[model samples]
Target: MLSRDRKWFLVIGIICAMIMTSISAWQPQTANAASPSASKVDAVLVVDVSNSMNTSDPGKIGNEAMKMFIDMLSTQNDKVGIVAYTDVVQREKALLNITSEADKQELKAFIDGLNRGAYTDTSVGVKEAIRILQDGKTAGHAPMIVMLADGNNDFNKTTGRTESQSEQDMAKAVAEAKNSGVPIYTIGLNADGKLNKNKLADIAQQTSGKSFITSSADDLPNILSEIFASNLKLKVVPLQSITANGNYQDVTVTVPNDSVLEANISIMSSKPVDARLIDPSGNTKPIPSSDVLLSKSKSYSLIKLLKPVAGDWKLQVKGVRQDQIDINLVFNYDLELKLDAPPAQSYKKGDSVQIRSYLTSNNQQFQDQELYANMNAVLKVKDLDSGTTNEVSLTNAGDAFTGSYTIPDEHDYELSVRAEEKSFYRETQPITISAKAGAGSGTNTGTTQTAAPAEKSNLLPLILAGLGLLVLLIAAFFIWKAVKKANRGFVGQIVLEIRDENTGEKTYPQYKKLNTFRGKFNLHQLLQLAPEFSGTDKVVFTPANQDRIMVRSTPEITIEKSGRAVDTGSGLELKNGDRLTIPLASVDKTILLEFISVNS
Candidate 1:
């Protein structure tokens, strides 16, 4: 009976050991427990059907290139839609739809059958794209617009319309999208190779987007890829600040996040310098800060629920790595943010005004980040006139940034972009764009306005004239005195002489009395222009080459000094007569000298 009981005990012990081993092996990763959430990306593709695209004869063939790009998109796993436009806008049968085996097959067929012929109505196409997107029921990531075209806008020409008119229509579409938060990308195909580059480029840049020119169909994809690269967003945010006794602090970091993001999140930065945070117990503890992935490169913070319950803390990130390596940034942004609308505000031509505030932000993680930060939008605008403002980001350091505005047309407008969060930053300079034009009738009856500022004008000639008049009066007086003093032939000398102490010689030279001297002169007493001298120890001169009359307590007639110099930030500056004067006792020559203007 005792032997049987011992056997049972050993068997139970073995069973318990096996269970413990299995539990340890299956433990979850605690390090990734708290991480930031990811968001979405919305991209819209707009293709051109202008007459130029119809000709595929090898001379800058963008017509076929558009189809090629569409083919590439057919392969991408991005949320996209398509639009085609000529004098008016149109969408294919499978326009905005979910990407699926059947959907993609249809998309492929549509692209393959595309033919270019109608005039390019760039603005109208953008309008239709925005409308389709805004009205769509499915909400995902930020919305973006991409367009490819090669021709002057004929929408305005055929309708007897102006860019201002187009802008008005575009403005409506853009406004809807802005409320949605969309960014746009534009490609101008100058097949004739002579499109208005400056105008088209400005339109693209205004959207915080880039414009690419492809002379061949094959190179279009490469250019589009570059635009994709620009879509990447990067930022560094202090996760949480904490305080502890004796100045120790805690901090967490939030890196840039993306929508439908891909690629490993990485950083080249100085190692975390004792980053810490305060716990609920009021004790300071270190917070891990390093070159670690936030949401595995998908979200802003690696840790989702980082809260500093106690103290004061700060975070730091250098642009480069320790050992001073160039920062390597590689990541993709998930795009999705509601575009509210394009700027609907307008002003008179040459009036200083601002468009409107626009923004985008992280939607999935917005619940927490909304209280602290956000992002700015990119745009594409056409028909800007005088005093046009270029689109610029107010802050790249953090997500909250502002945008600039410009004046171009007096009508409806269109702006396209990828969707994003747009916010105003206190430190970021305020976006202000305004223009002042003559109060006259012209095409631009519309303008954006701001507070009035003084105009700049040239006044150089007026200043010079004032100076010349004064100089003439002084010269005429001197000439009259010379005439009264002596006969015309003898009056020519007007006697000017100097005494030399070293050689004890008096030299007198014949001089010509001035007929006239002109221009404004400085006031006799009001203006005293003398410069202070410093670092003069370098000055030195040979005594044998000097005269004693030029010195104190000596019979000198010339005050020649050494070659000391002074330094200013720009370089040494000198005046003809700058000195510390000393009185002279006597002179060898007792001849009378004339004062026909000492400066003369």
Candidate 2:
């Protein structure tokens, strides 16, 4: 039996443990904490396929723009879907996770095969796109919907859907998208001078997206480029216009920094032009090679270079003699903005706090002065009690953006930072601060004094409840420890082989020894050894019993065994000598894992 002192000490220890556990459980997971290199996006393209589009867009430039958008996406694990709608949904393609060149080709083929239909319902297209995102979007991915329309609602009475009904539906869908934090970008073609610009602008504004109006379908590609850049927080830089003389013309494009994941060089011309790239090392890189991908349409040529070296690279373009060619480069950087903590730990009404924000990429500060020249930063503050938000501009002060915000009222407030340019925007996660009542607010000393006795009386029940929870936690800890020990003998190594589904080529078998790891073993830890498997960081394995291991994976990873799809949601079990094939839906590769047991 323990003495009174020891009993009190044990009780204090349990209480501290309970408090720590509760704090851990209550803290929210934030996207800002993640490395910018792991950025992933899920997008849906909603196209208007009404027959009227044929008159507004005689050259089918909208289709070409859609294809260009697809080519612009260079990151792995980015998923895209399509919805072509008129009076009803005429054609729909579910979100296809981009894994390889083959998947991109599949999407382009779908766009090329689009057929126009009679009647128009803008709401139908937006609604379908939102539904697809809601159903297929992955966690931690930025979601967006791009709707290209040529006309407003012209509902057909035969379909029994009225114009008023369409408007109602559109409003409902827009509200749903805004609530879910999904932005809807709208592009209106005013070739006929009849495009409903007001409607498009309203939708974009309400959903925190941008609106574009083009008088000529020829401008579709550039507008789409802006939309893509803005949605992904990238910047578009234009190069000097060139007059191609039917020969290779030297044009210089400077990659700003190492943070750029992809540099998309878009050449806009009336006809297709040939392009060649010479990297900073003076090596002539092959077009459509492993590092370079080129997509050409009737009006534009787009070249995407993956992880281009940070320096001046020369691009040579050959076009028809005396033809005018416009060049633009969009840089997709893996970057995030970080807002510094307040100088003071606590605050009261009328207290002023200085705000400092900086940009980061790959967990390192980015202070490229040239890039900062074209950007603007702002501080966004929200009053938690009133649910109102205000933005204050932050001036560039050398390496960081600086501003100040004064506590206006006694309430909890959230502060964040945003950096933007004409073509792109990026924001940081918000930090909350509480401002309490101060001297001028009111008299509160007597109220606080009267509540002390009631607060003391409530302490006993809270302590008793904590003690009960501590007892249960102790029992659970011992049970978990016992189970962990019992499964310790099931040590094994996994034989892994990577296969490209498109090429039908298999890599040599590799071995990863799963030694003693507490709780669960993460397969992503082993996959991280290879740069190609960078996006799959959530797959985990746990020991189920002495002879079997439980497999837990993200939805993007499709598992199969014995020619049947394994229900990963219900918990997949892998026994000794079991062979499993896991196909990552985001990339064009499959992993083959064979568990081989070894004695401990």
Candidate 3:
């Protein structure tokens, strides 16, 4: 019973709301977004599974150390892939994006399943690792390869490969890795005194990586820790060493600032140790709770705490009497170093370009004055043509560190800024800036430069943006309808396994056939198959195009596939053979699903 004008107004309001929603969807997320993404790491663990390792690592301690390395990865986006090789590639696992505890467990399981081959050829391992990184590397993630071998090359005479030929192949592979900016950290085990130390050192030096030779297999965890920290621009801080008297001993660890995103406290001991952690608030926190993970091996225990409070925390540990316990702390910070681009794209010789570097946390300016009190910053300039490098010191300038570099010559140069403190450091991505011949003396060095005034705003762009937003809204509506129509047909059955984490009880495998169901299949319907999944009735699965199923889950529920977290907010598609692990946090239960054969 509304009037015509009132109805028109209502229509206009609806249109405005749709346009606003479209604009919001397209806008970039701000600093307040949940858990801002950290700089990612893509690493390939290349271990030699040669028979010689049997004599060198009889305890198979290397596998345990590698597992610790996998557990030390603290971020959701960090990826790890495993490569085992001898004379040939014995096994290879693709880069697995670490998103949940399941992914870490999967990686550790792969390491455990490694079997030794009869011969050793380090080249095959290195090359296979490089290939995996080159193929599966995520853009913007720092790529690295850690190779562990006894530094021997033994090919069967019947295979028709010689040591000289193998050396040539290794040289080529190293060059390819170096050109691709992948550093190869080499670990040479010399337990048998036959390790070719020079060979490993040469490969490391050529790729700007580090080389370590350990006489004892037990020293692996520390070496791996060092390499991990060094690659991530972090430092390993050794805490106090203590002797266990069969009673609980207290150790204090200091987290310097709030910028630290993760702090992994590694306790090394020969004997098993039990640890209890006390937060700054004097509350005893659970060791294996969400946001805190404790990984224990035969030789060491790693407690990884996400977003640790910035204060003194205490760790109480009980170990065997007279056992020496060594503790180390590695911090992964969200802090980033930003180098502002120069005023001009190209400059002439003798013209000084001002370098401005600042630190950011969670994608905003980090205004912690105390953190910058003793921090030192430097500008690194590398000559692209001549291959020479030089560093220039920068002085603190309130919010940013400022320095000036006069274009010394007419060659193109790559520049990066590095800021460091006692605890951690950050370096900016290198940028190339060019300078042309002919200029005056470098008199503008260390001088202030004024910024140009902003121009007047225009209305045309705003009007076009509004029209674009409307078009986007209309297109999105149609796309939604299309997707809904595509997900209508019956798919197949899903074999389900439900586990109650609270009681550590699991239900037997159950099957839910989907041939009778049409339209979207939701968890409410799925619950009939498993009475134990009491509270997961909100998750929905729609049959997507091409025999796939699209998933939509409540925000509180976490969904992981093969080791990667599925962004259920945007929707995720699953095909046949896909396995999904859904953790119903509200009910303290988990559901595992396997997409089996499709119905005809």
Candidate 4:
């Protein structure tokens, strides 16, 4: 009996050895079928088992769903494995490859043994799982990493390293997997104890997987099924179709990027469907080396948004599609552009002013559908001088177009606007706008405006005689005893020698002159000075006779003008030691000289 038992044991051992060898060299290959998948898929589930999960609802749901999923995959399998994470990989084990019945039973044992743990280091767990998938010699298989966490990645930073270092290390591991075309599926269990929908969405989106914000434990199974099936099958909705040899139109394809996996959908057009693709950066790319044949039934079309940086992109399709697509394809797209005008400006009654407008595009470039559109845009100005209207063009720059108009003596104005491109279709609709006459009333136009009869000169001009009043208000203070003043320069000039009653001075009129290099001096500006300081309402200077000062200067000077003066009569002047307070003051050194017409 002992001999017989030994003989039987040796036979069983031999059989077991054979099985192990085959699995270790599984060399799993894709099975050829009628409808074959693009690649062989191998997925891993990295589950969280932290203490918080003990009290969280998602954890409970995750646990239950995983139990059932493990059983299902264990029996009907593909290349699958599981990793439970918590403070570290908590399963007392690493990875379970259940390719055969014996292995399936062992997996069941492992799952049954995973009791809840105390804490979680999601980052570490994830990093470990990724390492396994990356290390295993399972070439040709489309690899996937599914990691679940109940909260933020709060793993302790590596000792002696900066936070950035830790992040880099974590990122390094992820990058390695990505470089190998291994997509990581992130499942955020959330702190809400339920699933955090928004956070879950980000995880699913980032990893090319699926996300679920469950309200209860029951919803987990359905969500898990969905995530797994995301890769198994893709549902495409034909929102709209384009002409035969043309590009796709607003094809908003939604394939979960959580796995870092993307697919290319194609349509063949019967003719040259020229495709112009525009990215978020306003960059344009025409599909290279490929052309659409003008065959009514044999055109090929495809759009692949690969190496896709995460974000919404606008794809402008041009050309045609083959009739086999069963699409109601429209051959064109609208080219819509927009113009943004600045805030409105206005002027006082009777003031005519010049205004400006700017332009930009609402849609990038020109849409094929709108190719035949008329190149005209409408710019309507309200409260403007009647008969002021302009027709702009979208074919031109919207911003730099600068549409200018006049606001004539109007208190205010409104600007109405819309860009119109009429062709096969109304490229874009019009938008109403309002601007209050941007600029109005030119310089001095306001200063010289009609003023109500000057308040009856409260003080009459003094007619006192016997002092040949040398009121000598030398407008230009710098003195040059009249050696020259041309047009006013001294080729030869005359002056009346007068006297001052107060000081019995001016005995000899101190002639103020210009030390100029005598020529046809078109010197528009001269003597620019300011006291270095000023007040909003402080009196600057007052001339003796006139109500206000007369600022004079030549025209056509490239440089800016400066300084101001006023009548010093009534003791109201800017001169030092004068007790009288001046009337008004301004900081801006600009003063306008007006031609007081003799008719006035």
Worst 10 residues of 1 by lDDT: 542-551
Candidate with maximal TM-score: 3
Per-prediction TM-score to the true structure, in the order listed: 0.32, 0.66, 0.69, 0.31
lDDT of each: 0.38, 0.77, 0.77, 0.39
Model 2 ranges off by over 4 Å: 1-23, 26-39, 154-156, 215-217, 343-345, 366-376, 383-398, 402-404, 408-411, 420-425, 438-600
Estimate, for each residue in 1-600, the C-alpha lDDT of model 2 and write its tens digit. Answer: 346787678667878877665555444333234423334678888888888887766777677777878887864888888888988777666677887767788789879867887889998899988987886778777899988887487778777888788889999999999999998888776667788889999999999998988755357656876676656666567786888898899999888677778888888888768888999989999998998988887778889999988999999999989988989888777777888776443578888888888877767788887777778998989988999999999998867799898888888888888887654567877787778655232233465457667765666666566777887876775577677666553356677878999999877556566775656767777675566776555567877766467887777667788667777766788765567887875688899887644421
As for candidate 3, its clashing pairs are: none
Model 4 Cα displacement at 536 (Å)? Answer: 99
lDDT of each residue in 1-600, candidate 3, tens digit only = 346787577557757775565556544333121222354778998888889988766666667667877877875778887788888877666677888877798788868867887888888988878877876677677899988778888788888989988899999999999999999998876667888889999999999889998765357656876686567676667786789999999999888778888898988888989999998889998998887888887778889989988889999989999998888888888888888877655677777888988988867899888788868999999998899999999998766899999988888888888888766778887777778554322233432222111111233354456766765765675577677576557555676777899898767555676777778778757777456565566688877766667888877768898777777877888765468998877678888886643421
Instruction: Give residue 533's error in model 4 in angstroms.
Output: 95
- Best-to-worst order by TM-score is 3, 2, 1, 4
Q: What is model 2's C-alpha RMSD?
A: 13.3
Tens digit of lDDT per residue, candidate 4, span 483-563? 222223211111112233344443221122222313322112121223332221122221212222222222221112222
**lDDT of candidate 4 vs native?**
0.39
Show where candidate 1 strays beyond 4 Å: 1-40, 55-77, 93-98, 137-140, 155-164, 171-179, 232-600
The C-alpha local distance difference test score for the whole of candidate 3 amounts to 0.77
Error of 3 at 439 (Å): 10
